[model samples]
Target: MTPPASLKLASHEGRAAEAAPGPEAALAIRGLTVSYGQTPAVFSADATFPARTMSAIVGPNGAGKSTLLKAALGVIPRVSGEVTAFGRPVAEARERIAYVPQRASVDWDFPATAGDVVLMGLYRRMGLLGRVTGAHRRTVRACLGRVGMADFEGRQIGELSGGQQQRVFLARALAQGADLYLLDEPFAGVDAATERAIIDVLKALRDEGRAVVAVHHDLSTVTRYFEHVLMLNVRPVAEGPVETAFTAEALDATYGGRLAATHMDSLILATA
Candidate 1:
């Protein structure tokens, strides 16, 4: 049988070479390999995320899901790989990209107010030595409003509850006005209402031609939200449209025998 369309996007071991992503892709990673000391994390991963779409990165625990985002951003070292944002190297395309790390990874008691946090997102656009103008404050307010956090702007970031905090972080990303967004578990620990709020903002971004790629854990919600799926198990298991690539077999390969609890078959229309 032929390999799945998502798996055909590229080769993890370099056996089936694929061409570089074209201009239409908002983010692309090829031959991405990451290692810590002698231990390897991600190996030869490849995938291209097109613009104006939402993509989900899913995998079992320790499957290198978070590694993909950090490695691509160069926050961690990469043994080898090529990462591009709108066809430009990540370092060269910082302004066009926004990253919202897992909320738990940050210390909420950092003393910054919510408004202050969002202002940081505008620094790149304002440039060095450029002051935050009245116009800049207006933009921050608008972004906060978009995330339903307008009333929380002046409050201490740490004082807010879990869902409110996530919205604040999203407001910061909006203030950046990025063309591509990489978010890690934005829904983790958030209430259903907050999750809906965040997903709505993400959908709005996609509608505006921006790419939203997120590391998600709710296997049941992948097809409900993402247009594309990238399944990882220390390497690429599958990658492509959710309709075809997010099959039970593909998920089985990615999660091994651990797939039973999710009842993922109910989420898909059929086996691949």
Candidate 2:
């Protein structure tokens, strides 16, 4: 499938092109292998993510999808290999990348307001002993507004609905002003409206030449929401454009026999 017109233009201009292998990828994982104790979680995974595209990491349960995202963000201990961002080591590029973990992974009762959570993103920019200035507040407000959470600024995080909470976290990621976004399950357990809103926000980010990688399920939405897809089952099953990687055969290989059979039937009907 062809990339969107905006991505094509960016490629022609040599600025934030989705397909031009941006500066050796906004994020690169090479020979990356991870293990927990004696059991290996990911094995010899290698991938490059160019800028100005939305990439989805899709796989069945226990496929190490979340583990891959965490390892890329340096949140998990790797047993081997390397992860680099913008041609720099992970540590050096930390400030340039933002991570939004799974909603189920966070404690909603952490006693922070939505604005407070958003402000956490500014910590990297503000040194120790630096107070949040009016400028920072304005930035947070703007980011909240962008995610349609302006009125929720003062609301406690635990009080929010599942979708609202997800939006709040996305606003926090926006506040970081990062060039790369690593999001895990941003669409799980949300209302349909919230899902659409998140997709729109991600598309906008891609248009602005930022790279966003999401650990996503829901095969039905994969092709519609992402241009690139990484299919995995504890290893790299496939990685490329959604239309290329999200095929029945690839899905069958990643999801095992039963689900793959079901998905193939669905794919046939969709095409027919």
Candidate 3:
């Protein structure tokens, strides 16, 4: 089958390949490989998420979806490969990127209010010994309000419901004033209302000329929520506009025959 026009297929030679990200690329990864004690998690991955677009990274369980994000962000070590944000090294462009980890990975038991957690996003501006001025508190309040958590600002994180907690974390990311947003399962375990709210915010960011990339699990919502897609297993299967790259052939390559025929048909029909 012919690949999508913009999709970047893994090199047949089993070597790391570069992406033709062009000039507008907001985040680019080439030949990224990661391992945990000799067990490979990701291999020769290549992807490019461009500015002003919203993209989704989709794959089956244990597909190293989250590992890819961590490696690109320099939060975890990669065995090989390079990652750049806005055509610069991730370290040099750190402030331009914001990452929201899987909600399940966070410690909700921490003794902090919803507002306090959001305030952490501004820590870079506040400095280690700096005191939070009234302006900072207002900024925090504004971020919470943007995610519909304004009324819950004083509530402890652990006391909130799953959806509320997710919204609070998103508000925290919003406070970062970032040009690129990386979210890991932002819609996982959330109510329908929360999912709608979150997607709206992400779309708004895209409209504002920022980039949003998420390690997403729900294939059913991928076409509705995103403009571009990166289908991945350990390596990239396809990467490009959703309408072109999100085909059954690409999905099969990424899943390695794990998806049942009936489920795949239904998903195609739903997205179509």
Candidate 4:
């Protein structure tokens, strides 16, 4: 069955924005909290994500890293405090932001080609009543080429390998053309080559004067992959450059217990 026309249109508009830059953020967040039913996932998280930098949200599992990103986008039901994009409230400025969810969260068997998925990013600009024109198609093709997936436009998403599928989603997010990108676990469960490719795309986005925030796992790659870091575990642990925030003390605070401390000690001594 064909997907709803509205979905396709919304997708296209999201992608169209990628062709140009968006306004910069002034004071992005003050006090943000996200809760799941009675339990709080992210608590009083505050940080300013400057324009034109690559930031990584790093922590152990259940650290509410993903919750923070979702809260910023208003995807989760319960959230408090302020989140602004380009100096405006997030709800009022949703068009300037884009999100790429974790690959494992999606249903690969969903009937959609790579191009169809990429076009979904353009939906915001095209509106529900809009049709996908030749320009949109060309934009989609160019986005695919940018990610080295131009030849896979017609392939079923389910048929692609894990790395290939991840790249497709990244391409879709690139197609969105937003200034602020919120990506969740984009590098999870992929090959080393795929990881490097994803990092390159993120750096390119940063070079274009856009902010890219990603919820990432690999502690080793955090320093190398991102220019800024938000380390979390149910609350704000640290926020700054990788050299400062990724320290032994901060990692212990975010991770808790002895395991993190032990690992951190070794990491510190080795670095010294």
Clashes per model (N, Cα, C within 3 A): 1, 0, 0, 22
- lDDT score, residue 244, model 1? 85
Q: Rank order by TM-score, top first?
A: 3, 1, 2, 4
Alpha-carbon RMSD, candidate 2: 5.4
lDDT of 1: 0.86
lDDT of 1 at 269: 52
Error of 4 at 31 (Å): 1.9
Q: Is candidate 2 or candidate 4 better by lDDT?
A: 2
Q: Worst ten-residue run, lDDT, model 3?
A: 9-18
Compared with the true structure, what per-residue lDDT tens digits does model 3 show for residues 1-272?
Answer: 43332244223212223333223678888889999987889998888887778989999998999999999998899999888887789999989998898899988999999999999988877989899999889999999998899999999999999999999989999989899999989999999999999999999998887899999999888888988899989878888888888888988898998988787887777667
Alpha carbon deviation, residue 12, candidate 2 (Å): 15
lDDT of 3: 0.86
Q: How accurate is candidate 2 locally (lDDT)?
A: 0.84
lDDT of 1 by residue, 1-272 (tens): 32343354334224312343222667888889998778778988887877778999999988888999999998888999889887689999999999999999999999899999999889897999998899999999999999998998899998999999999989999999999999989999999999999999999998887899999999888989898889999889988889888987898899886878458667675323
User: Which candidate's TM-score is highest?
Assistant: 3
Q: Point out where model 4 deviates above 4 Å.
A: 1-27, 258-262, 265-272
Per-residue alpha-carbon lDDT of candidate 4 for residues 1-272, written as tens digits (9 for 90 to 100): 32242243335335544534432342265568888888888887776665677888888899898988888888875467677786678888777788899899999999999999999988987899999999999989998888888999999999989998999999888888888889999988988888888888889988988888899887766767787788888877887667666788888788776455666776545434
List TM-scores for all candidates, in order: 0.90, 0.89, 0.91, 0.86
Give lDDT: candidate 4, residue 28.
60
